[model samples]
Target chain A: MNTWEIRFAMGNEAIAEGALAAGARFYAGYPITPSSEIAEIASRRLPQVGGVFIQMEDEIASIAAIIGASAAGKKSFTATSGPGVSLMQENLGVAVMSEIPCVIIDVQRSGPSTGLATKPAQGDVMQARWGTHGDHGIIALAPSSVQECYDLTIKAFDFSEKYRTPVYLMADEVIGHMREPYVLHEAAGLVSRKQPDPSEPGGDYKIFDFERYDDHIAPMPPYGGKYIFRMNGSMHDEAGFGCGASDNADKFIRHYEDKITKNRDDIVMTESYNMEDADYVLVSFGCSARSAMAAMRLARQEGEKVGVLKLMTLWPFPDKEVAAALKKAKAAVVPEMNLGQVASEVSRYNERKIPVIGVNRVDGSMITPYQILDALKGLYLKGLSLKGL
Target chain B: MKQRWEIIFSGVGGQGLLLSGNLLGAAVSVIEKRQAVMTCTYGTETRGTFTKSDVILSDGYIDFPEVLDADVVVSLAQIAYDRYVDVLKPKTLFLYNSNQVKEAPSPARQVGLPMEEMAAQAGAPAAVNIVALGILTALTKCVQPTSIQEMLTRHFKGRQDVLGANIKAFEAGLEEAGK
Candidate 1:
């Protein structure tokens, strides 16, 4: 295949293209602000490629359809906004317990409920990590730009396949509606799930559980495959037979936790900007990482040794790498669109002693470069120093 | 070792700021064979508030990819022009439509062009974006005009004849900017 050139396309269009490239044959979603375009594009494009697109009655049904389609062997995805994300939480829990591999795209807007439909917000940062209940772990990657919207969506589906779990593509309004040149690489390492061995006798198959929890990600037999087994959200034994015992319940939770927790190194990702020998470090993710990089470059030109740690993966947070960077830096500033959601995590590494400042904006607009630069200047004037972490 | 530029295009929604930035990014990526990234944010207020796009063109992968201080800033609305004028780097160049914006900010060298009138004269009312793209290329010498034409042909092949007037409008913009 020839190397394809990157050109300008809307973020929604990029998502559709990425899904198509990553072998997602079905999409179920409802129309909502900042995310409706994904459904619109998918509806028009999926039919031509022999894929399926369905506009569900609401967000609840949308996620349910996605989960159902994935179980039936088609790679499936759904995109939604603030209110829609809230409505789909229950089905997401069902998907987690059932171990169905799918992708969820949340183009987040400002609000607890329908606050600002078209405005940008990182308020759902924590929500993406802990939206569903119980001891289930999910892979969530936040794309800072339109190109990443394409690249990360593919990665999200791959992670879901590898772990036999659901993944979240958490994008904000700023990155969703933005038009950027998106070059689809022919060599973009695409990952597909493993199919169960057909040669293994049907009676020996276990769909949900096994003797050991470490290999919790068992090969999933797709629909129409020769293997025969049952799958459910309820607690089950090694043979996938329904079991209500407390030990079975404990083992189920352990399987969910072990699959993700053990692969934290492979899941966590961060990009450092001029971090070596830096006096100050700025921790930012999603759209705010764009502004933080801009501010860092300007500060460097003006003779300030400032660096940035841009997080590409939100869940399975890279705590070790972040802590190491914060150790030698004089101060750390976290700038985000929400009222400092990621700053809470940074504070967990070192509290009030590290001169940890937060530059927050809740006005549904991105934090500008001047705001971050001013915060850095204020920290310098106050002579606040970093704590020895 | 290679040419790298960070360009920003800011204006109102209907002014086609995003289109201009996209055109530049496309030209740089497809024609120049460089890795280019463009990102934008338009206000929820529809056509009234300022809309801005940041474009970064580099030979290597752009990791810290944000438009900090632009090497070139283009504006079609007075509000966007005034907002970024003083904040832009002293070396940064400014290009604005003289028909819409009458005043130029201090310090930076400003090149004003009657691009809307030129596009109208070229028989395309909405071709002002392509017109601005041509003028920006001529002023900065960042991408070749021939490469831009090749990119436009590849990008608008489906539309076909719609590009004839737009190409003429771009040439008119180049001529007007020269004066």
Candidate 2:
């Protein structure tokens, strides 16, 4: 493993290489803008690495194929945009109920439905958390730079394996298309799913042993192996037999929530920039964080105290840390490519009196640093005073 | 750190400005080992549409990645030149090909060259991008000539079909930029 390999790579290509480095053995995706480059790179690189690359008919089948591949004991993934992700919601629900481990790389674009293919947006911030119906938790990580696109994709896979759940890399077109020189590490820190030892015996070995719900994990037996059991969407017992009892349904939801909610500390991650002794803060993630950093520099230049809280993991949102960071600020600004999706989330945890102002833009253009700086300047001037929050 | 310099190359589709921008970043950031960022956006039409790329070579971190204003802008076609001319700073160094463009934005900012014709004369019309890159490298002094030559050698090494002509055209650009 060469530790010093540097290349001028786009965000999408970096994702494919990162997936390879993380030992992803299968990929199924349909080429869509912003995210199409991931499929293109995977098609070329997966075969060389002795992995399987399947171009499915549509986004639904692409996710379905990866889910099936993951069940069959292969590290699998798929890439899509907002439109495709919308189609994947049903299958994603199916994956969550069955606890199938897989990765989804969603290069987000501006959209309610196919709004802008080439433009960038963070509109999917909430979608990554609540797109699937019913009580289910998902791991979604947003990368702010081309290098993080590589580093976080590997982390996405690791979390998927650790929790036996689906993980998402919610990227936008800005980071997906931008080229930057990055050096890939020799070996990535990885966590594999706990597998049941074959010598431990197949006799009465149940797949869904609920007795271990505190860990929110069960050693999944690969489909092709000798272990024989039933897997279904309906409520199931410890041995994975279909059950309709009220108690079992209650237990199912509890364990489902416990898997993610309990491990929030291990899963939820955020990066703060110049947060020490700052009176104003900017809560942003992904490509918007780049602009927010620039805004922080400008605000500091003007002798104003400002910082940034860059969220890498969108789901299992960090409420405690965010509330604490907002305590010092009279106002916090949320600048995103979308119209205030994450801004609303920031306010929920903002128990402090800090007024979180959202500077939004979804008109097929990126939100520049100047826009954020203007919003920050206007926030304290109009919304609050120094004594507020 | 040297004062941050930005370069944008604009031209018609199929003129290889994207590759030129890529190679320039490869030369300065990779070969010369500096901080660099590169991006390009183009219209839907494959040919006859305006395609351009921007590269910023800085000694340290690049705060804003995109080029809102540039220190040097190379315009290979009349339409692209006309579109981006007004977006220049007061001291921006403008490079244009006189064969494709009829006039300059301003006499002081313009550094006109017969690059397209020189490339065509070298029997590699597609090599005009390399010629412009060489001329920009010389005019801005952003990248060393040796690094540009190394990038060209690494790019066109396998295909002998157009190797000599591209190098010749780049030399012609370098010589013309000196005058």
Candidate 3:
């Protein structure tokens, strides 16, 4: 084992390192701008670590390969950007319904369709939350720094394994390429999903049955294992068989939902700075949080009781903490690279209209500290009291 | 005491921005045993689009990932200078290629180096980034020159000829800074 040490790595390369450190054995991805480097590094590094790296023909196949690899009892992952993520939606949904454990990273660029391949955008925040067509649950983590790129990636894999569902690692172009010093721990803490019991008869091993288990997260067996059950996208029962009954749909949805919702305390992760008795709070995530922190410090120096709330877990939105912050805050500011994604959600909780300010930038540029400071000044000039709700 | 500096390397694609970022990062991380992170961006156009590589080196944990206000912004292209001038603090140093960036200084401490001309003079036109790195270390003392040389040797350990040219280019840059 090696001591913790700081290392320089591009965003893509850092993801590969994180994935490998997390015990990822298979990488299936198609090269795309801003994210191709991830594929490139995986190709070089995965094999060196006795893992497999396959460049699939397209994003669909890439995700499918990971899904299949995960089912074969391997920790698998794939990296993609906007269009590629769009292509993998059906399979992503498939993985959701089948309860497969894997990690999918979207190094988001500007897009509806290749909108801005080289530019940074948080447009996919909503997509990551609700991109699939059905009412399925997901675990999405947004990393603000390169170390988080490595650290959160490990967390993404862990969450995927613990919950038995596909996890999303959302990153923007600015973050994907930006370099920072990060410490690589000698041994990363990883959670591997429980494999099914091999002693049971192959027919008796119900892959999704968990009536006797403690939680909704059903243990699964790899294909070669005794539990050779069929899995599909349709709502299924304990046997992993599609059931059209509405009751079955309820059971199916609740299964994965509980896996995450019940574990909310363990899954929900956030960072707060000077927010305990803050008069005002800033809610921001991803790269924009960097600017928000700088702005908050400046605002505090100017004698404003301002603080910042950074969200690490994007999906299963940290509602409890957010609501508590809002309750104690006079006004809330939501700043994002996107126009109004998180702000829209903040408004729902803030019915008091305590001036939930939205500071947004959609240009191909990263939001700077000046823009954030300007927004604070504008809010102050408007005579909005920075007090508690 | 080990001091860590987060340096943002900005230039256009094909200017070896990512390569330079990697070289500098590898030098610091692999040689000095310091923590380093490097991220790069290349616009759609592979040849003439704006490209940037930001590197943060630290002895402690680097919680924030993005560059807030760069202590040193190295611009090798005109567009890089134009786009990032407003981001640098007053004390921030702007180091640009004398042959490429024909812009005025936006920072209190600014120095333009003849990177292209110097690399050409050193008989390695593609070593502009290395030369610029040399000049940058001299002016800012951001990283030790000897440490960088150690990095250079490790970077080109397998190729002696390329190593020789890069070392030569680096010396030329050091001499230019000395002038």
Model 1: colliding residue pairs: A6-A183, A7-A181
Candidate number with the higher lDDT (2 or 3): 2
Chain B, candidate 3: TM? Answer: 0.90
lDDT of 1 by residue, A52-117 (tens): 999999999999999889988889999999899999998899888888899999998999899988
Number of the predicted model whose DockQ against the real structure is largest: 2
Over 4 Å off, model 1: A1-4, A8-14, A145-147, A177-183, A187-190, A203-205, A212-214, A224-231, A234-242, A301-305, A351-353, A384-389, B1-12, B34-36, B44-113
Candidate 3 segments whose C-alpha is farther than 4 A from its true place: A1-3, A351-353, A385-389, B1-11, B22-41, B54-113
Docking class of 2: medium
Q: Identify the leading candidate in terms of lDDT.
A: 2
Candidate 2 wrong stretches, greater than 4 Å? A203-205, A383-389, B104-108
Ranking by DockQ: 2, 3, 1
By TM-score, who's the top model here?
A: 2
| Residue pairs in clash, model 2 | none
lDDT string, candidate 2, A1-389, tens digits: 48767777788988988898889999999989889989998999899989999999999999999999998888999999999999999999878888889999999988889877777888988888889888877889999888899999999999998888999999998888877777777544578778886577865657778466457588887886777756677777877778899998888777777788789999888998889978888999988898888888877887777899999998888887789889877788998988898889899988866778898998877778889877866765784543321
